[model samples]
Target: MKNILHVFRHDLRRATSNVMAVIVLFGLVVIPSLFTWFNVIASWNPFENTKNLTVAVANTDEGYQSDLVPIRLNVGEQVLSALRANNDLNWVITSEDEAIDGTKSGEYYAAIVLPPTFSADMMTFYSNGSEHTKIEYYTNEKKNALAPKITEQGAGEVSTSINEVFTEKLSEVALNIITSLSGYLDDADTQATLSRLQARVSGVAAQLRAASTTADMFTSLIASSRPLVDSASGLVSTSGDALQDATGALGTGKDAAQSLKDVLTSTTVALGDARSGTADSYQAVADSVDDVFSSMNAQSASSADALGAAATRVQTQIDQHQQLRDTLVNDVRPLLPESAVDSFDRAVSRIDASIARQQDLHDRLDHAATHITDTDADVQAMHAEITGLIANAKASVDDAQSAYTGSLQPKLDALAETLSVIGGDVDSIGSDLSSVAESLSGSDSLTTALEHAESLTTDISSTLTETADRFDALANALTKAMDTGDLSELTEVIGADPQALATHLAEPVSLKRVPVYSVVSFGAAMTPLYTVLALWVGALLISVSIRVDPPQGAASDLPVLTPTQTYLGRFGIFALVGFLQSSLVCLGSVLFTQVQPEHPFLLILTGWVMSLVFTLIVYTFVVTFGNAGKALAVLMLVVQISTSGGAYPLQVLPQWFQNISPFLPATHAVNAMRSAIAGIYQNDFWVSLGLLAAFALPALLLGLVLRLPLIGFNQKLLRALASTKLM
Candidate 1:
């Protein structure tokens, strides 16, 4: 210990006694500090100002003039304007050829060329759906890693902005149209239009009534002609045969009418049955969906209940832990010896903090779960209501079909029976006339009767012809008015529930976003990890040049110094230099950048501690292994770069890296710094600090204590330096 102290005092005096040596000593601290500071500063938030990197934009897009919209769509122009406004990229307006050539010549980081049909393809969104418009993003990887990456990011940003603007504008237009339509549907003009249609339908019904009246008049004429035909049969027996043939035709007509009536009745019944079945099926589906919803509700409730119970248990455990911690801290700690009290209180505090962290996580989990179940319940209730609406519609259809069948079927049956009776009367009259014609074949009034019968038949046939004409005119008029009825019903339905109709037509499904945490920006998220890596690398870089062994210019008449004295004396200087370098870098970042660490003092203190720890470990390697240690330190830097979880998460890496990460000083440094920066010192914060202390203390001890015993290994350092001639 005395020799180590002697060497330290001797070295400090040698360096300070001479003016040149003093200048060199000051240079050692200032040079590394400046090197770390300026280099880190140059790269700090490098992407923050990407305005210098040029990206050529060639927009050869034509505007699409849509008939549906008043304005022409020029998405390319909008994108170009947005690019100009945005500071993320230096967007240069140029031709395609120029853009391509510039990217090839490294004048631009990337080139984006829009096709001529960009707006035309985008306009198709209203007609069909989203159509992808290709904006050619040409990147030159040879420009360097970052430039290509940044340019691609810029291109992606432009694409997203274009999509957002187009979607927003389209939504606005559609919503405006819907709003206007809703007002128009509610206006008095809509009711007038519907009333006109209903009046037209009423006029059509009147035509049907006229057709029926004509048919009834024709039936009366048929009954009246039965007597005339009967009277003439006796006068002209052969003409009576013609009457018979007419009566048979009537029979055929009656059969056809009966068949039509039966068909109508059966069809009505079938439709009613179909409606009933559809209603039943719809009900079944609703029931099934409801059952599943109930099951989901039950499951969610069970999960929430379990989580709540678990929360209660965790709270109980926390209460118990709090009681113990409070007892140990306030009551028992004071009674314990001074040495035991500090450690006991620290242990109790760590346990209490860990418990609190666990409790917070559990409570949040339970709360989120509870909210999830509640939302699910609400969604399920909405689904049930929608199902009920569908069921009610089905029931309405069933009732309509049933009512129509009940009222119209019997009327058709009665009409068919009336036609059958008319046919029977014609047949019976023809039969009676046949008997009378044979009996009265020689009567004197035969010619007069035959003429009268012929005249009556002619008049009856004319009446039938007029009846057919009337039916034809009525059918055509009814056909025209039926269209008006359909239109009226449609208008009425839309006018009644335009809001629901519009909502359903616009978006059948919706996306609900539930945010859990505020998204942190890239700069804020990466600051802590990068600071840790930079501090460690900065320590490694400068420590290599600072020698840990006694200088050849030291007093030669003194006793030879052991390796412990050499290692300690050299480490004191390295530690001081490393501390200055790391502290300057951190302070510079804090002063210059927008780094707002939660615990500002803790950030500086942790950084300084990390510097001391890293300096000791690195100082050990340099002193014990000499130039071989420098190679090892460089190798360590490479390894730590990958395994440190500085950029990517450790779990995402290979298993070997994850297994080794917990032991690495960089890991703990980054973890502690992140907690300090984010103001979230969870259970891992103190553990990382402890690990850092554990690494630093043991390393420092081993470097000084083991340096004497490992003299053989120290001698090999000289051999490695001489034989390999390595630096």
Candidate 2:
């Protein structure tokens, strides 16, 4: 430890005592400071001078005229007028050819040219399938790296200004139209016309009210008739059922008529036979009576007349039954299915044949009575034949009576009951239909009320049409009257402050930027990086100018120093120079330039620590490996400069650079200084300082522990370089 102190003091004295050494030491201190100060002053406020970047402007608009607007619009001229007042960039007005040539030849940073159809396109806002108004922007990107970016921002400003102007103009036109409309509304003539229109509309409304009243009456009529309609439908259905029953009854009556016809037919045939047999008997009996009673011939004549009269009565009975059957068949025939018509007709024919047979029998009986004047021989035979004939006629009459009572009479009674039911249903249906028809024809029926409502509605529609036409004519008259007055009076009537409104509409939103840990200028914000670079470069200058090892003779007066002692003693001199360099660079930043740090002491302390760490690293490498170590130090500086997040953020660097950035000493130094300059957040300043100080440990190991073992090899390397006759 004594040896280390002795060597450190001895080297310090030698470096200060000589004039050349003091001058060289002074130069070393100022060199690193100059590097940082020059850069800081150069970049103090770069964007403030961007107005000097030239951008060419060319206007080629032909202007547009609108028939409805009564004005000629030239958007290109408006843009040029706006650019003249803007100082964000240097706007040079020229022809299109000149602008393009200037931009290409690097005389201008960028060029903006309006097309010939620019104003016409702007006026096509309400037109279909229109092209957008375009301002062609051309940039000479090769002019300067940042010139294009600045000029691009200028082009964006130009676009924004154009939008504001266009919006302000549209708002003005709309406000003027609204002002005219307000004047029209205030006109007394227009108000009178509107009053008349309102009166007409009221009349239409009265008509609608009358129509609504009629509609209500119609609705009530419909509601009342619903039950009647249902009853009528039921009555019609019942009538159909009853008619069906009547048809069945007709079928029954037809069968009864058929049975009666059959009985009459059998009775007729039986009577015919009885008459033929009794005719012979009557002739013989008449002859016998004539012979036996010559003196009583008058009695025989009376009996013969009696026999003829009885035969005539039987014929009258047969004709009456035939006529009744014929009437029943004819009535039932129309009601029966078409298929039963032929059968009913045949029954009628059979009844006619039966009547004919009865008529012939009557004729035969009358002829037999008239021929009874002839004499006969047998009286007993005549009496027996007469008795047999009476018995057969009586039996035929009794059989017919039984058939009529059992089959025909009961069927006829059923048919009458069915017909009575049908008559009652038909009467009910007729009553229902009469009631419906009366309701329909009545004054307050649904159909009548609907017709009245329709009439009222048609009148209301016509009245509304006439009112609309009057309103249109009134509006046209009011427009012409208002147009005859001075248009400027409209704006006065509207009572609007156009200047205030236009200003608000043009730039409605004002941005208030609230900066966090705000930096005053570009150079001040860049102080951390430049300060860090100065510290490392200061260490490099020290390494190159001063030796890393103690002089062999000067250190001999002290006891033989161990490698650790030797390494510390030599590092003490380098560390002092690094401290001096860091102080001048950090203090000069705020003192000489415009850099104002939140914690000036912390900023200086960060620089001091970073300089020490950087010096130890370079000194260790040089001490351990001789000249090769200096080259290694230079390479390390290059890597740290690129990856240290100095000029640009570490995030913006390549992946490899970012990956190695955390391990570099400059990375932590820049971070710590930024915290101090920008106002510390959390423990960032302390943490970054701690990381930067950590580099000293590994540097101490390389110089003290590792340098001892490589001393021989390092000496050989130095000797070999010397032998090459170059360094």
Candidate 3:
């Protein structure tokens, strides 16, 4: 261990004297120090407390003509005014050419140019619906970073202002158009046109009203005529009933007369037979005459009974007619006019009187017929007795027959003529009923015609009412159209101009002035890592210098030191020297550059840890492959520097490069250091520390293992001599 320390001290002293080693150390310390300074300067707040930002504007738009005003403000002027009014910025208006030159030369950060036909194009956009006359901004891209961004924002603001003005103007124009339309509609000519329309509507309405009124009158007339029609219809029905009743009575009378005629004929035939049989057998004739008289009497009695029944039926008919007459006068008559009622009453009375007369005639006829039948029966019996008595005296029988035939035949013929006259009277009454029925039928036809006319009138009234309702709707629609007055007003209430409205509400933009600052050049962020790399290269050179020296004399055969002490001595000396080099670099940055670290102690500590890790790595490789290990260290340095995203973020590198970036110690160191400098708190600092520890601890242990055989006094002198030539 004593010899190893002695060898370590000898190697360190020789390393300090070598020109290449000193030069390598200086390059490592100075180059990274400058890079770190530049990075710190680049990251400083350039825009802090920046004020009075200058902005450029160019407006070339011509004024517009309005109906009420000769000239109106152009869109460009409106944009300019809006920018000037903004409290966030100070706007400077310049000609288009001047603004452009000033922006490019960094005199002005941003420039805006309003198109030549801005107002005219906008009007054309409104009138012809074209998209033209876009607002444009010119900005200096390289001067200050914020300048272009501010210019972009400013151009947006100007566009917004122009849109707002255009929108407001358009709204005013719409309102004015509405007002103009209202005036035009209220003028005499338009009002006259409306009046003509109203007159036409009113005329149609009047016609409808008249038709309605006429319908009402027709309905009233129908109401008034209904009673008369009803009465006529009732009279027709009643007359028909009366005629049917009279026809039925006539049928009954005819049937009874025919039966009575048959009975009378049968009686006459029996009487004649009895009279003829008396001469053939006087006694037998007398008996047959008695039978004949009995038969004749029965038949005559039946005929008389039939005549009585006919008379009673006629009497009943007369009573029914009288009742009908009374009912017509008391109940049905008042329902008709006085003349018609009286006429019906008279007809009923006449029918009743006729029925009474017929009844009397039938009664007289029946009584006379009954008397004649009884007389005939007596004569038949007497004739029969006389014929029997005369048959005994045969010469007087013919004379008796002549006397009986002459008297009975004349009375029977007179009865037959009376029955025929009564039947004729029944026929005449039936004819009268038929005439009344025909008159009632004619009245019914007239009543039906009146009902048809009433229905037609109702249909006409309904049609007229529908017409009036349609006219009312037309008038209301016309009134609403007149009240609205303007098409533009309708368009606005209905979301007609969506794009213009959207443009109007957007935020106004102005040119943004970016404060100028010194920018760090490319690859400046990786300066500290590069410096650490240069330090490792310088350490390798020193290690080679110590190893290549010639051996001293026959060395003491002291046992080799343990791998731990031998590796520790090499690792410790390099670690301390690398740390001293990193400290010098950080000190140079603070002194020469205006780089102020937020946490100076932590920054220094991080640098020290990085140096130790690099030292262990250099020692491990050097012990493993001797002088050839220097080439591996250089390769590692290249990989670390390339992978570390210091100058450009790792994201900007190719994908494969980004994949291997975490394994590079330089990458971890750069990220951790940037986090500290930028006040970006992150867990990556500890992680980076751990990764560096892994590299440093393992390299130190491995170097110890590899150096175990060379730990003795003589072996250390020989290893030092070998390291010197390799440097």
Per residue, candidate 2 scores C-alpha lDDT tens digits across 1-727 of 7787898898889998999999999988999999999988999999999889999999999998888566677878988998999999999999999999999999999999999998888778779898678889999999798889989998999999888877776666645544455355567865565455446645655665565556556556655665565465566566667666766765676565565455545544544554454445444534543443343245667656655665666565566656555555555445444444555555455445545555554564565466555455333344344445444444444444444444544554454465567667666766765675555444345445555655665565566555555444434443443546443443443346664566578789998999998877999988888887777788888989998777665536555677788888888899899999999998898789868888989988988898889989988888888888888988988888888898888788889998999998888998899888889899999999999999999888777687788999888888888999987
Using TM-score as the yardstick, the better of models 1 and 2 is 2
**Model 1 segments more than 4 A misplaced:** 65-74, 81-84, 126-131, 168-547, 551-570, 582-594, 648-656, 697-709, 716-727
Q: Give the per-residue lDDT of model 1 (tens digit) for 1-727.
A: 8876676666666667889866765665555445544554555567778998999999999878878455677878877887888888788999999999999999988999989998888779556666677778899999797788888888888887777656655555544443343244445665454345446545655665565566556556656765665566445666677677877777776766656655555555545554555455445544544554456466766654544554454455446445544544454333333334444444444555545554553455455345544676675565555455545545444444444455544555665677778777887877787787667654436545555555665565566556555444434433333434333333343344454554454454677997442223455556656666665666666565455666544445345766666677656666766677667756765675546666667777778888888777777777666666777777877888778786789889999999999878888887877776667535666777778878877776778676667768777767776887664
lDDT of 3 by residue, 1-727 (tens): 6766764675566557989967765564455455555554554443432335667788877767666434464767767777778744457888989888888887877777888888877766756557866867777788877667765766676676677777666555543443344455768776666556656766787778788888979977986887776687577667667767866765665565455446435544533453344334334433433444456555765644544554454444345435444553465433333333444444444444444444444455345445535566665554444344334322232332233235433443454565567668767866776776666667667777888888888888888888776666545544554666544533443245544544443423556887332124223344455545555565565455444222344562233544554555555456656677778766654455534545556566667777777766776776666655677887887776667776567888899989998777777776655544444455766676667667666675566564556446535555788799963
- Backbone clashes (count) for model 3: 22
Superposed model 3: Cα runs more than 4 Å off: 12-31, 42-58, 63-71, 75-112, 119-133, 136-573, 585-600, 618-642, 647-653, 674-684, 697-727
Provide TM-scores for the models. 0.48, 0.58, 0.38
What's the number of clashes in each of the models?
1, 0, 22
- In candidate 1, what residue range of length 10 has the lowest lDDT sum? 485-494
Highest TM-score scorer: 2
Sort every candidate by lDDT, greatest first.
2, 1, 3
Candidate order by decreasing TM-score: 2, 1, 3
